[model samples]
Target chain A: MGNLRERLKAFYADYSFYILPVMKFALALGIYVLINNRLGYMEALNRLFILVILAAISAILPFNATVMIGIALIVAHCFGLGVETGLFALVLYVVLVLLYFRFVPRDALVMLMTPVAGILHMEAVVPLCLGLVRGPESALSAACGLVSWQFVEIVHDEIAPLKEADAGMLNVLQSIPASLFSPKLLLCVIASAAATVLVALIVRHMTTYTRLRAVIAGAVLYLVIMLAGGVAVGVELNAPAIVAGTAASAAVALFLNMFVYSVDYRQSRFIQFEDDDYYYYVKAIPKMRAGGAKPVRYYDDSSRQNGTGTPVNGQDVDGVDFKTKLEDSLKDL
Target chain B: MLTKQRLQLMISLADFKQSHINTTMRVTKYYRNDYVAVQLVKNFFVTSIAYLILLGFFAVYHLDFLLTNMNNLKMGRLAAVLLIIYLVMLAVYSVITYVIARIRYARAREKAEDYDQKLDLLANIYREEKQSSGNPFGEDQ
Candidate 1:
């Protein structure tokens, strides 16, 4: 197991330079597809060749720049739906960005996770991941992301219903309040995300089984909150779909923890040492070993064989012990 | 060709750079320990306020439905139950954060102290070396 892990780590280190760019490109493509499918705005812009080119370009850009492009695409989609919708989205996003900069500018990942959560339908994974890799303060960023996602979703839904109707500025503006105050949508998004964050925060701090257990607990909490909130808001529940989605999300979360945040539980060490003036107590935690190639050992047969078939010290040639023979050879030299 | 003013300016610049590095290190240390707790508290308040505002917006806009729901005793009971759950969650979360923060702070302080001791030892060694070499800086004095 250790050898395999070492080999895996070595392989990752060797190929990460290539892998990262590929992953980025793939992620960009996925984001483009998601937005195009979700909004169908800019049908002309959604040509396969253009999307591929844009994805490639996005891959080379910095992460924040990529996110900006993605946001721009979403806004373009909103504009395709209606000018009022697009303007409202732009204003909302500007506000979100300002809040992000003013409070937690470092949490760009959480901000990105907003649209991802909506598209993936796995909002629980965001908090689970953040709790593992970041501090508790990341919850604020997650909340902001959820709100942004909900806002966009509300706008999309409202515009969808009025697609055939005359979607003038006034009509679009009139529909905003209904979408904004839709108790079911707000409650489900907010409550589920908040519950997941709370679950992740508490479970991740536990001494034993932190990441895996947090993922499980977080997924459960998210489902419970979503279901309960749905009930409270009089929304019909889809039990089977929710169960399947939560299960798949938990599995993905587990896989991510294994590959990204794996730790060796057995290699933990506690040491006590003393210097001239102070006693030092240390707890050493070992990270998971990456899989690597097994070491090969070579032996020289001529050294063990002294011109005679019999081995050194009268031991049989076939059963000659290497350590004893080497020691004898060294002593003789 | 180097003037005294240029030398003095160079020395002051070096001093300023060194002080800046030291301040950065100190700030990083504080952030890794004490600032975590502060950030958690701040996040809690900000997230709570944002949630409340969102919920409040919905309630105000849907005042008729909200008032009708509020008249139901079941709604009050449900709110109370939800509130209790939230309170319990908060309590647990606080304890966990406190414990983790304390451990991290202690570890960081220990590392800082060890680093300081090593630095002091290095300084002592350098001083001894200078004295043994007949004090090159002392020659100017």
Candidate 2:
């Protein structure tokens, strides 16, 4: 595992500049393709050539720009359905944008990912991983994403009926607000929000197998809330689908945690100290390093005496001090 | 003409700017009051626009009912409720923006101070080398 980590790190370090653009391209392509698959109302915009060109351009742009493009595509597709549908989508997207930018400008990706996850039947992963990696505040983005996706579903369901009924624009518009605010969507948003906050709290407070516990607890909470709420709202609950999706989401969360934020619990250290202001009890866990137990940096005693070495609670073993530069850097915070 | 050490320092500084200093630079470019106020105003506009959109939808949805009961409806109470909702939303959004802007400004200022100290240290090194009449690519370097 350590050797594989080292090779991956080296490869990333050497090729990140080239790799990042390619990854962005892939993500853009995936998002565009997913959008087209879900709502291919506009035949012109549904072409692979246009999608490729747009995704390629988005790859070179900032991520938020890509999200904006996604929104535009959604609105365009909604417009292709009807003017009432287009207006409804436009207002919804505008409101979402306002709320998202004001509260969580950094989480546009989450907003984009939610609908995609829904389409993939992996929506549970969005909130679970969000809670594991980010703070409770990310729930806002999750909620927005959930609402956006629910709106998509509402549109999908409504499109066929509206077209068949040959409804007037006013009648179509009147039915929109009702469909958009369905009890099922509300319950799902509540479930997602609750799960996100609960997982973040568990991960933040727990010290042992934090990611594992958080993922499990989050998935369970999400399932319980969704199932109970679905029952109360008279919505047909897909028991097997929900369970399978939750399990898959939990596995994905654990996998992401392993690669991105893993630490060695066995090598954890506890340190207690008091200053004039407060007494601090700190539990420091060592990261899973590519070199295993090797000291991150070495400092001779002379360097300390000369005030050249950073002052830290470094543990010395075998004539080498494991540097705690991270502690030193975070001291001010 | 850049010395090897100076060139290395420049590369490090550029890397820092690219990787870490962008948010700091962007935030610290404005005074604290100016930054926070600007964000608050932006939030106000966004909230207003969103509120108006919601109101439009509500009005449209209830257009028939409202028209039928227009004579029976409490116009003043309805207006007051709408105003209160708008104010509450504006207040919530403004407060969030204010807090976020202040926190960002404080962090940016801290980072800017650290960057300035680093620049000062580099300047001092250049001064010391100049005082000693050292070559640009000295043996010590």
| Candidate 1: chain B TM-score against the reference chain B | 0.54
Per-model B-chain TM-score: 0.54, 0.82
Candidate 2 lDDT tens digits, A1-333: 646655555555556667667878999999999999998898999899999999899889989878988988988999988888888898888888787654666687776788888888878889998898789988877888898888787778886478668988888888877887878888888989988999899887645466688889889999999888888889887889988988888888888777655532232334554333355454444344424444434257887677676433232334423366556657889
Q: With candidate 2 superimposed using the best TM-score fit, by how many Å does residue A309's alpha carbon deviate from the native? A: 22
Evaluate residue B61 in candidate 1 and report its C-alpha lDDT on the 0 to 100 scale. 50
- Which candidate achieves the best DockQ against the true structure? 2
The TM-scores of all predictions, comma-separated, are 0.57, 0.81
Error of 2 at A270 (Å): 38
Per-residue lDDT tens digits of candidate 2, residues B1-141?
Answer: 336675445444554565577778788889999999888888888889899989988999889999999999999999999999999988988888899889989988998887787777767666666656755554345
